[model samples]
Target: MVSSTISLAPFFSLSPSASQSQPPSPFAFRRGLFLVCHAFSQSESQADKPNSWRQLHWKEKRPRRKANAISDQEVVHQFDQLLAAKNLYQINQYLKDHAKTSNNSYPTVFSLFTRLTQAEGIGPDEYTYAILMDCCARMNQVNLMFGFLGRFLKEGHSANNAMIFSPILKGLCWEKRTGEAATIVLYKMAKLGCIPGIVSYNIIINGLCKNDEIDKAMDFVDVMMSKGHEPNVVTYNTLIDGLCKKGEIDKALDFVDVMISKGHGPNVVTYSTLIDGLCKEGEIDKAMDIVDVMISKGYDPDVITYSILINGLCKEGEIDKAMDIVDVMISRGHDPDVVTYSTLIDGLCKEGEIDKARNFVDVMISKGLEPDVVTYSTLIDGLCKKGEIDKAMDIVDVMISRGHDPDVVTYNTLIDGLCKKGETDKARDFVDVMISKGLEPNVVTYSTLIDGLCKKGETDNARDFVDVMISKGLEPNVVTYNILIDGLCKKGEIQKAIDIVDVMITKGHEPDVVTYSTLIDGLCKKGEIEKAMDFLDVMISKGLEPDVVTYNTLIDGLCKKGETDKARDFVDVMISKGLEPDVVTHNTLIDGLCKKGQTEQAFNFLDVMISKGCDPDVITYNTLITGLCKNGEIDKALDFVDVMISKGHEPNVVTYSTLIDGLCKKGEIKRALNFLDVMISKGHEPDVVTYGTLIDGLCEKGEITKAKELFYEMISKGVDPDAVI
Candidate 1:
């Protein structure tokens, strides 16, 4: 016997010369040669003797042969006849097959099923309703699925089939109605004597994890175990991923141990998830250790694993280390994909290495990897940070030319750049462009604009943006509220700042540390130290720890009011809170003490500052010198200038002006004249103050000729003498 073969060319690909739109019809051969061959193949398999080529050719040539002759309409007519005879088993079987084989044409299958049930003398059985329910589930009409379930129960069908309830559980879980899914799995399924299998439980667990209901997901795992359904690797991975995402890496690691003990070893996905969590938590070293453990277990890290590690390194500002990993990835035959390159670009941009970041974009393009929206956004962010807004705009143009529409993040980056450069108008225009492009400005976009306006002292304009943002249904977050309060404070509108804080709380935006810090600083600047202190107590009561900026603000406020002792007491309080005083704190204190004629006390604090390893900056030394000169200690002030220079601090115009006035006030006329020559020789031009002090000294000495000559010299130097002269 010879086996006949059918050529698939005519049934599949079209000829090169065939009209592209006029290909062979699928139904043309589907109802003809395809069915004839199918019937012949079945008969040949069951035959006692193989059929000859002549017999096979006869079947192929006469595709309308009896067994394969029925048209689709005739088949439907026969199905209606079966339904009329109440042969429900056959009707249900046909419907079940149709539902399963419908692919995505679920609505059509459902319509056919509905018409069959509505036929005269036709009633759908339990299996028919189950098929209908499955159809509803597939169509995302899960609400209509319940109607089919009702029909199944009304027909007195057994509810013991777990498969029948699986679709319902899946639909509910997919809709994030995990509470209902759980109720069905725990109570309704039991009521129907249908115990859910692992697949059904896994679906609910996965959904719960995705919705950030990790605790509830874990409780279901316990229930699943109690019900004798052992959790699989997928079950454990879902829980681990949920825990990791919630920043519960320790708990996620514990789950990994539990998973291994239960004989389900962690796979690449499990390790990658763990590494990603650790990286996000800034535990890059620990993440690397996990990767090593993964490799020791014979599971080589894939591209995703490498990308996660690179991202972690980039986030930690270890850009060079991240690049080393990229090289290792390529050497190991895994290419650095767009995500890996984008992560590196973001890192470089953050480090202010904009040129290097652009070079990376070139490298990525050279490797035939198209820069994604994230990659382009990162480059734009880098340029914006470097104050190259025009170049950033050029990158946007290039991004558009490459068919990549700028996403919300891309627009937000551009807005942030423009606003920081004091181009608030341009930023606002971009907002319109974003809306025109069908992307609504998100919270970050509005927040950036609000912050820019506030920084430019346009508090009124900033307030308008806040109102617009709310009208757009985007509520002001804590950062937004903090920006508004800080702006109001700088404008001396403490009452308005407080009102904004009140509105923030009313809107359920609890004041974080930044909010309280900004308020404290504002109140301090307004000289309402007592109220600022009261806010401190409120902040502490609310469990928000005041940071260094808050304490520095309070200390500066007290020192300014000649309350140096109280400022000292606040320092002790700040230290007690475990926040060591920074340079700003010490400078504020020194400036306060010097202003109060407590030179010895100021010098004592200076020693303490040094002992605490807080090096004095130029302001620190200048404040001390100003105090000495005010106390008529000319020699001491002069000596301190030498010490300042010895400490590598270059005295600016203030330093020279202060010393010149000190010498002239002491009537050291020759010394004052010599210091002026030294000031000029040191490239410090004499300002009106410097010359006025010298000219006044000459007049007091009754040297009218020298005073006139000095005044003439001041005029020649173009130093505009003020009324004090």
Candidate 2:
């Protein structure tokens, strides 16, 4: 029996070269069987001969019959080939067949899958079920992955291998299945004796935070501590980003403090996220404070952090502060990258400081920083705003020359600029150029051109652009309707503007404050005050709250129509709704009252304005003084001038002139002269109008000598007297 077994081993273990060339013949099988039977008979005949025959048969078969027993190296090679094809099904079949044939060794199967996973080309094998679970998690196929994992665990697979379960946990976390992932991780670690590492905890914490589960994420940190796994920098960063994204900037900062206290230093990403969140919330000063903290913590702010602060400052119209930050960044030995330069350029452009932005571009290039498409687009936008279409076009040429292809934004900037310059033909040509470059124009691009046409009073052409944009599969945003509404209103097409509003509603775009405000202002301008109010009613019916600007527009419109009582009612409605009337709102309301000869009520509104913490601007004083003087209330108007000066608000020429004119209109030549003296004493040189008003008043009062002296004084002060003199 021993000799027979040794002889049969040769049939299974043919030499590698011999087995590849040909299939086993029947003759070879029968010959091997005959040899085995002969050896066994011989072994039975003599006990000593049996041992000798067995040893001789084994020696003979050793080299020729060793193929059936796969080597560890061969198993790894086959497993890799299968995995490379992503042929998990075939790999499973191969493993099962090999395991049955190789005496069912679990170590061999485990080693095969593990080694294949480590190979460069081959991915993790199905035998390493954790990899599939991870893939499922990554693809958000949580249920399907868990089902497979359940089968794996039931089939005697060890769940204790962190190498196997950790990836699965990470997958679950990535899919935002944090609770399930946590439960699985805890179950594997406690029940199945698996212990998670730092990476495993990071995945869960990050997932929880991303899903806006902040409290849950913090609880997970506690769970990690309980499991004796301290959270790492990645873990803290994930939580910070999550909190920042949810606009919980204060909580994010607190997390940063906790991270530092725990000895995990925050990195650039952590700082950038916090800065961006603060900027979005308009807490720009607080954002800058964090930047200082970041610097003091020995963490240099990166390009992203700089971009956030610059954008925030720009949005607040604090261009100088934003530029200061940029200078500081350069002085700190940090070369401004493309985004940093782009942000600064964009901010400068938006502020109408085109020349300064252009000079910065030169400086950026000199410093070896190549201006990207965004940089060019920003410059183009600035130039367009300044009506420098020729310079903006030159920028486009330079962009093409520099091999930095202009995108939709670049085209939109140029087109918008040309539109603003009343060059609709040139703007249209740019749209064509954009299309020829294989770039489909977006709504912003089309909307820009439409707005340009509308501004030039070519509402029909603007409507054509809208149709073109729609035909090209671009849906018009809220701005598109606004431009058309404004255009139609300008052309006295109020009904058409209202129709466009209906279309906007039909298309699922609600009319925002700008939408209603533009239409209302237009209707007011066209003397369609009742229709404007009806539109306001419609806006409110749509659940859109009127902003302070909306109320101010209506008040100004009503005041212009001599309906001061109705305008005052609007103010009451605005304040009752807890909407603090802005400076513009107060000025409009006060101007209305003063115009209606209600000087006392108008001045009372000024007190209310001051009490509401709304500082009255120069316009406020000028409007009130003009109204009071027109109504023969010159003395009361003069009191407001003194109040304005005392409030630290510098009265400009308009404020002084309004009072001078009011005094003159009331035939109070001496008071007008006294006011002019007060104005000149306050370092405001009297203009021709100021002297003319006083001289004219003096002439009306027959004080010709005093009028002549005032005229001579005006001439001496280099104020050229016009024909009215």
Candidate 3:
């Protein structure tokens, strides 16, 4: 009602493919029903019914009752009785008696009914075979469906009939046989005189779209138009959905205009697909803009649309804003499903707001939405991260008690937590537990366990686990190799790590940045700087450009070796590669410069940092203060601390302690004690290092009484003194 129109083509016909030979009774019942229906169309006037009935099977005149003489229930009851008794003859009679609307919705039951008949050696009726096609679709038994269709056609039913072709065509589509489905719709159906109607068209188009053959699907739309079939609303919706899924939102919107022009209204599904696509593409604002348009079109956004937006916002760390949308969603009469609540809970947990996340879980339950495996996993994962493994285990118990099976993710979370806390034996035990529970360990499971074993210096056991993973038919991915390599490097088994890299590359598992980085760092730590550079060159040749971590590792190694000039040159090379220098890069450089007595050069670089819009953080200032103090520029260091404070950088205990130790080293006891007083007044809590510095200064000055007094003060404050004190 709102737009323009497109032309429909002529309904092209094909020659009948059936042979002249008489077919068996399988087709007899089917052919009779269709012939009867065709002879007397539904659009025919009721007054012509009696005459139409007399023409059935070309029989002589007989007393004829009105069509649909028996009720649907009576026919169903008759069929049920016949089927239950396994009466083949009566069932045959029953099928022949009621080829009507009464049995339409119940045709799905024919698969089981026919199988029951098969037990009694009774062959299925034609309609039974049709339903069996559907049964195969349900079971994803594509080949069996084709076999059934072949028998149906051999029994002499016209294969070209839209009724005959539709089931298998739809079944093929259901099984994701998009290319095969297209073959049938384009060639086989055309040869059989069966031009696909909108239903079959939509099925193939949907299959094509799902297979990411949207371009081909669009080409099919043109073919349909050429065949005089105007693209219907379902047709257009499928195309739009396909485009949206392909991340071509602009194209999808343009297609909507085409749809509107065709006078085929965009339905809820059409707009919802667009909204979901937008959210996934991280275009939430545009998605909301489309939502407004959808609502303005008198189409109310359903739960799916709202949930998509909720999840989108959550992923973007817009939890408060997402909750606001959730309120709006509820007020708009859409209930938040488990997915929506799970997404929100996950977002909150990621932000380290565990308590807030747990409260939301309660609210979700109060709304009658049961927490699914994903929800429990999210909560358990959050608790584990916060080092509350006991609470996490309690949730695992609750998850089981609530009848939700703990999935791989759940166990993975527990395993990861145990690994981080160095309770790896427990992590090892959980693997067996998961297997006992009938849950297969995925790549993540094996990788995590291997990493844990590697961390505990159980590399041999980690290797055995990798074998166990392979034996269980799991392929170790690049990350699994990287973990092993890193472990080897840490244990000073650099050759073993390099061998793993070689094996990975030989196995066609191209080494990624982590793999190369781990090897480079290992070689660098071994003082094989030349080898590390060779690997860097190899990595570049392979087009794996080194990231900032790569540069940082190299620079740190060079600085540690007192090769400050080489490290500085490496930093310039790193910058040339389009990698920005991070704080770690700056800190490493400052430490190197200060050690080389280039403290002024380090301070000059600080100006360069500010000029480049890099705010000098506490670590930045701490390094500078340490550097200045080391170079015997104690007053300059004190002035730098003021500058750090003026720049709004809070001086940590390390900052103050560095200065105190400097003054103490210079035998400036009174000055050091004064600085300690200023540190205490500035709300800085003294650590053992801080107290030890002051104590050592007093003891060195032969002020044993004052040192003893300070030691007791440290003990009273619960700060333990060093052995030196």
Strongest candidate by TM-score: 3
The lDDT of each candidate is 0.81, 0.74, 0.77
Q: What is the TM-score of each candidate against the true structure?
A: 0.68, 0.66, 0.77
By TM-score, the better pick of 1 and 3 is 3
lDDT digits (tens) for residues 109-226 of candidate 2: 5456545545565443335575444433433334434444444554466666666666566666665667767776665455566667777777778778878888898898998889
Sorted by lDDT (best first), the order is: 1, 3, 2
All candidates: CA RMSD in angstroms?
A: 17.4, 20.2, 13.8
Q: For candidate 2, what's the RMSD?
A: 20.2
Runs of candidate 2 exceeding 4 Å displacement:
1-232, 258-265, 282-285, 288-292, 295-333, 350-353, 524-533, 635-639, 649-653, 656-725
Per-residue lDDT of candidate 1, residues 509-625 (tens digit): 899988888888888887899999999999999998999998999999998889999999999999999999999999999999999999999999999999999999999999999
lDDT (0-100) at residue 507 of candidate 1? 96
**Between 1 and 2, whose lDDT is larger?**
1
Off by more than 4 A, model 1 = 1-181, 199-220, 246-255, 502-512, 537-545, 575-583, 599-725
Which lDDT value does model 1 have at 371?
85
For candidate 3, write residues 525-556 as lDDT tens digits.
99888888899999999999899999899998
Would you list the rank order by TM-score, best first?
Answer: 3, 1, 2
